[model samples]
Target: MSAAPVIVIGSGLAGLMTALTLAPMPVVLVTAGRLGQAGSSPLAQGGVAAAIGVDDDTSLHLADTLAAGDGLCDAASAREIVGRGRDAIMALESHGVRFDRKPDGSYALGLEAAHSRHRIVHVDGDATGAGIVKALVAKVRETASITILEDCRALRLIKRDDRVVGVCLEGKGPVAARAVVLATGGAGGLYEATTTPLGNLGQGAALAGRVGARLADMEFVQFHPTALAVSAPRLPLISEAVRGEGAILINDRGERFMADQPGQELAPRDVVARAIAAEIDAGRKVYLDARAALGEGFVRRFPGIFALCQEHGIDPARMPIPVRPATHYHMGGIAADCDGRTNVPGLWAVGEAACTGLHGANRLASNSLLEAAVMGLNAGRAIASEMTAATVRLEPVSLPQMSDPAPVRAIVSRGLGILRHETGLRAAICALLPKAGHDDAAAVALAMAVAAFARCESRGSHARTDYPHKNASGTRKLFTMDEAFAFARELAASQPLSRTA
Candidate 1:
């Protein structure tokens, strides 16, 4: 008989690209929701960054990525991934992704934060993610070797003899597989004010950690500086592309507070987010003024954003849009290599779920998509090359209860916001330790809290009030679930509050 099919979790850009790249190889694609309706991929507004411009090159892109990483990025991984930009774009285009172009038939590139050149390749202005996913979804449906299972959530990974062999799906029994690839998105959904899909509550990290996978850089959660400041369950993002189009950030007093700051509106996301957060903390409401810059062209350039504003009874062309920092991305995840191979045998991770070290402590704008596509494709190829025909009967294992993030969301959001401190991190750790065993979200949150507390200095997206400066030497943390829980337990025991309460 043929070997069991490879099981891929999640249906975002990473998962989709992986399955697509593994064509003619039997694969099972799983997702918690409808194929194209789930995850943070479709909600992405910024385009993929590529060094295909006349004045651009891989070295230049790598330099920008490293600069944004704040001395924490793995230089080797950054260079390799940035160098694959043109290839990744071509691969996506071959899979039916048609990027926006100018009348001259050249790619229409847009500028964003931190990049020295206009390297963001978009589609229909702000709908780049949606467009790419739509085309890839259509392609996946036509592929003969891929079997898609929608609305199937992965609860935990099944490991045998120190190797992950399969995954237990929620509401369904174990699905035996030769290998498992996790493409689940990041932990932004753990935040109260976030732009990530509500269902993306760090399940990827939880699943890997439970199965003994090493996770890295868990403290660096990138907050977008300009989410629409409105009452909503999930905040709407005001993409950095708007600022690239010449929008300026102003306060209630109509002061351009970022005017004197280096790079101003175009600084790295962490810098921009902190600036906006500082303004808000000072009791001044912040707004993104696009009137003079885009004016009537606002709707034409960012139709999706324009409509979202209109729905909230605001117009970008005429008035300044209220904005605030919101959790947008997670730079930390399972410590996977360039080919998405985790330390665990037979298991791989890609996209936002895997820490390939390309983004470092913070991600360069638009580079997430580039990394996702490149790594996803690379993972698929690597997995295909390592395919084995050995068939083994899987034993039945008891399935655990489904993971719920509801209880942990408030705890995490309070402590791990744009700004963090020792007190808040410890409190979060204490509250989450007990729940880590049975609750996946709590497990992930507990690990993150520990990482945040251990890092004594502020760097990139992780800012600590007590430790307000960067350390001379920055370190990337790598820990398993056991290590995280042990650290939390030790820390909690030493604290006065834990002893009393």
Candidate 2:
């Protein structure tokens, strides 16, 4: 393949938007799965978080994000993202995305948890991600300067000294470029049950770390409060918007348990999910009943969720929907600035793969897509500007072969799911490290292990029973590859011989 001006890993919303923003510049978009299938963007139900309504302001949006994040959100990053939300939403609209509107031509807004006002702009009720991805993919196809390469997974980033040269793909050797953008989504698929696509396995974070990119807040993973508890191997999401539209959580005894919690069904995701999990742990079946609250309008509005419920033989219009906590989004990734530039020169990251400090501890509902668009745009522009000032050269690098991911997946799911203790996490790290040794899957597992070990306190999405108290330090934790390697080695040394590889 010919060397391009920029190489963007993953073809979801963020990667596509990053390429689109650099219009007229030669760009290559790579994906592990087919375009629009690997990331959670296509599975998003609630709309993007934007201050499109007259009642909504950037300040209000920022306040909601900070409150939902439980005091860990960076005020400046929150303000910047919320301030730019309208323009990003308008840009998506300009690209032929059809957002739902009121009868009087105003944008129809939906309310979600921790938000004081209606600010979410969705499409087709549910399936906002689908609508956004469709528009983005269409724009990408029409752009002559952009090339889409499907079934190509980025293995590792190539770095010479402190600068990233290019990335090595699985089947297609090293495709070099002046700049590289890692938008390879999250690690939800690392869990046994998750709403994320099967390939959302933290490859970008791993790739960046292997190249010595600084990673931040890797321990904080958001669990959606209400994923449908189906018999399928992987769990499916039941959108938070459903609760916003008035769904009530009930136990097998027909008790509305959420009434005992703060904000009831409208509580922040971590709070609500824990409550549901507690109910299940207490041997009560949990159900989300929206029949009385939403009525037939539920079927008309959220047709995607409605159909999913029908396929499971549970009609939201008739009875309650069974729900459980499912792995949703990762709040940590390769640490980057607002412009998406990593510590390594010629390397940048955006979307779910980059920890831009926008979603500090926990992300507000639907804010991810907005962050992806805004940051992707900024990254693309910044990379283009940087390339203009220097000569471009393509450097080739070799990638190591990977082993089966089944073992690592099982280890993460059993030891690192919603609730974690020190023993389980340590054991998990020991079991996984050997299997992941020097391979792509191992690199990804190492990042997750390092992050999980660093954060001991129970806060937001990452709850530890051993360290139940929230730490007063409150400083953001960042890790480099060397630091992570040292920590992993130390842990391995402390463990028994059987645990070590």
lDDT of each: 0.91, 0.83
lDDT of 1 by residue, 368-476 (tens): 9998999989999999999684466667777767656766888888888888888888888888888888888889889899999999999989999999999998789
Q: List the residue pairs that clash in candidate 1.
A: none
Best by lDDT: 1
Candidate 2 local lDDT, 1-501, one digit each (tens): 444568898887889889999888888888888887668888888989998789778888888888877777777877887889988888888888999998999998999887888989999889899999988898899999988899888887777667776778877777667788999999887877788876677888778887788988888888988989997766778888888988899999999998977789988888898888899888889999999988788888789999999999988988999999988999888898877888989899999999888887788888999999899888888887777533435456656776667777787877777788887778777777665556555566666777777787888887888998788886678988668777877897887546532
Residue 414 of model 2 has an lDDT of 73
How badly does each model clash, as a count of residue pairs? 0, 1
Relative to the true structure, candidate 1 reaches a TM of 0.98
**What is the Å distance of residue 250 in model 2 from its true position?**
0.5
- Least accurate 10 contiguous residues by lDDT in model 1: 492-501
Error at 19, model 2, angstroms: 0.5
